[model samples]
Target: MPKNSYKIPSSLNRSFLDHEVALSGGGFQAKPLPMKVLLFWSGSILTLFWVASSTFVAQAAWWLIALVVIWWLITTAFLGQYSKTKEMKFASVPALLAYVPAAARRVLTRTSTNPSSFYSVVGIDNISATGLIKYSDGTLGQGYLVVGSASILLFEEDRKAILNRVDSFWRKVDTSCEYTFVTTKEPQRVYHQIANLERRNLALEVRDPELKELMDEQYDILNDYVGKQFASIHQYLLLKGDNLESLRRAHSVLQAEVENSSLMIKGCTMLNGDEVTDMLTVLYKGKSS
Candidate 1:
């Protein structure tokens, strides 16, 4: 019998359970703390101790101490929830009683200067038809909607390789430019698209009973999924440049890398001006984009 020869696959192609992406120095860092939680807690405790140890504190009326305790409890609860919210303050007990009316008045008094509007918060000075977003600070940005998946079907090694490529691309890009990857959830809207397709192909479906039955089955599956209000996950890539030229360069580099590399990115769509606007509106206002 003739000798048999077999080829062994490369170790890089072997499936693994997990992988990690290496990052360049300064590519990412821990968030800075302006003030420590421990410091705040220490200060609060010291203040309370100073007050309670005072001569008048011991001689204070019972009702007065009870009122003070109630106030402290209320303020502590409020601070626990809204400490980071600067505009919201616990003015007094009277203010709490009038919260509803005060909230209505605040709504009436809201203005563009307060960052209540999408444009103000987003700082978009202009949006070009070609999908470049110009900011008030002279930065230019572009957004891309990414579609892809990672599941049991995709080996762990493959997932890591794709992530490594993505990390390399980020390190290769201009350091001054800002790049962000965001994942969000939205109500499923794909069923509507399927419904529209079914309507458009009604005549074809009528001519082929088999096709009609298949289409109906698929539509029902999607419709049932939608009826459950299961949120669909969306991924986005946002690139901001110091200037228009830098933005264009970054966009080209991204497109080339994504197309040439096996990053497992199945689809990427650049958002137009209107689409960008709608996206921001939906994000800020909780409305459909």
Candidate 2:
């Protein structure tokens, strides 16, 4: 007999994960639901009551049950959309509570459904966007963003390595004197852009309004400071001229003040903001620039 070759069919792809959209606490980190007798029997009893509550003829009762089933399905499905995406925390507890709910409200403002493909958190300022990152086991990761899932797969996973790379670029400058800094203004333009982007594209819908705004605002503040700090450094360098050691000392003291002030603002962090402010005062007494 001639040689016969048989091919095995591949199974359909059905993973617990939704690769296209990976939000914080990815791939069903949802708490295991409490499936007690109350939930099970309550639903069952309600279902039975809903069916038997009707006193029409058998055929008519069947029609009524069908109608009820359809209605229940619609309501549950619609509500399910809202509950799909969970929120994350920011700096303050109040901010966390306020913004996340806002993000959800923003989502509800337009469509009844959540974003189809991706997940996003709109910061308070709106300019700083953290692209969704993933850890190896599919957790919400922190690092540089990878554009696509294919890119995520191809680039090779190095979460720790990339995070360290980000850490290396860190520059924390301290200032001894009070500075003219712009107070934070919410990014109205970016806010609208995000809304417009979500609206124009049916693929990605925003989930929480308040949370998005908080993120957007924080981004604006960070962005505004970034340039000012660099300029301040440049100005100091220019004014110092030949005295590099004095400049270094001034910078160090200023840095310490900053570290202190940061602690104050953060309250529980490494240094208090008041401590930073005090150091800055001392440095100011010693140097002019």
Candidate 3:
């Protein structure tokens, strides 16, 4: 966690065995220009020719032709230079020719119908009491809240030890099962404390005047801080397997790793039904209800 300390070398690496057959049976090159860039440039070239031909037929002004040519050169040159970067390799074409037209067609041909429920769309059947989430496809998953890891506050040597333990933990994990780690910032319900305080004040049968004034001041302070509170970062880990038995095995391995092999994890609390629902809402809907 230190700014300039040594990093643990990653144990996860692509195996040549995985790509051996594909490499030998070659079709397209391993890496090429993104499809979106190819499409955009192709469309640009066709549009350029079409405009030029149409101008010739209409006897357009000479300045018009020069302006179009200059614009085309500038755009193509700029894009060509920009596309040299690694990020542009995954660029997508504009939605005007694809998504926008499809959306417009859908609107024009709209029909009244009930929308599908969120659970149906996400393919989640239920979250069990013991923190197992059963999906429509029969997969069982368990979610855990990573409460805290204090590696950032540790000295250099301690941080390195934590990193080594983390690496060992990953290496010892069951590779066949699926695991996902997510980190996100979610807004905390800072208004709840004030609301609860107000409720308690109202429910009191006998309240001292002095105590009441202090409570009112407390409520005012909390109310003022409501919207200014910082969002808390949450880290989650999901372990998934094909069936209950495999899921249990994975969970055992996870517990063992945390207790015996890893010093990087401070706590891992399993999520119940409500907690699972809240986590899902934060992940997909971008806010927790």
Candidate 4:
């Protein structure tokens, strides 16, 4: 939990290994430049420039030849410079690297007119949860935005808040624990299901018959916070685990964590929602009565 501490729990460590989930094979992807892809777009732009020069400006044949030469020189020179700068940025950017595997696209994505292979950028637009991105060698990869470990520090409510926490987590994760993000269409409604039950049980706990509805409302927010934790863990697993064994282990760990925080998670049964509710009610009543 400390800023500098890099240790993971025994079970979580096993889960990480079991998943074998890595965003990249190495420090960075080494895809080569896709010259043909680059040429297609660059050629289109050059053609337009030539047409404008000849038709609008009344440039003669020799002038046209000179313009083409100038365009090639400028394109090639700029491309070379761009590639060097991009490599530099990729190698040095701190905390920012968290977004690289997904955010950083290879040079081919930009369709840059820079004739040099080194002048390409990772991607030209903003990074996001899901978007098609082209790599330097013209291979297209989907952007996968994820929720991070750090996000667990704060409770998740909205998608943006969840994303920010995920962003924060990846920035801190020195290890290979990949994080992920997702949204439920009915987060609020689903959250209230457990919350309503918790409040119903809590109300029965005390005979202070005053402000029952008000008391229930007060607990509503707390319940929502608990629900968000569940959602975060679920999304995290989906992003990290691609195999059945790993998902199974992750589910086990999640159930254990939920039970460890029993008061909030309401006993954290391994059973499905219906069974969980039954167990929660029985446990709550045993204590209340």
Best by lDDT: 3
Taking the tens digit of each residue's C-alpha lDDT, what string does model 1 give over 61-116? 87877676567656655543323322223334565676656543343223644444
- Which parts of model 3 are misplaced by more than 4 Å? 1-121, 148-153, 189-207, 216-228, 286-289
The positional error of residue 262 in candidate 3, measured at the CA in angstroms, is: 5.9
Write the residue-wise lDDT of candidate 4 on 1-289 in tens digits.
Answer: 2243455444532322123222346577544433432453466567756765666444567777668667866655453332422232222346466547653433332345453432332222321233322234433322221232333454534444445443454554423222333332222226456666666766685666566676666566556564444432222122233343444454455445454532222232223334323322332333323
**How large an RMSD does model 4 have?**
18.6
In order, the Cα lDDT scores of the candidates are 0.65, 0.35, 0.68, 0.41
For residue 55, what is the lDDT in candidate 2? 43
Residue 284, model 4: Cα distance from true site in angstroms: 39
Count of backbone collisions within predicted model 4: 9
Q: Is candidate 1 or candidate 3 better by TM-score?
A: 3
lDDT of 1: 0.65
Per-residue alpha-carbon lDDT of model 3 for 83-163, expressed as tens digits?
A: 323323223345344555653334221135433444445787878777789888889898998765654468877777777
Q: Highest TM-score, which number?
A: 3
RMSD in Å for candidate 2, one decimal?
Answer: 24.6
User: Model 2, 50-107: lDDT tens per residue?
Assistant: 6556544234666777776677656544433322232111113475567676554453
Residue 81 alpha-carbon offset, candidate 2, angstroms: 6.2
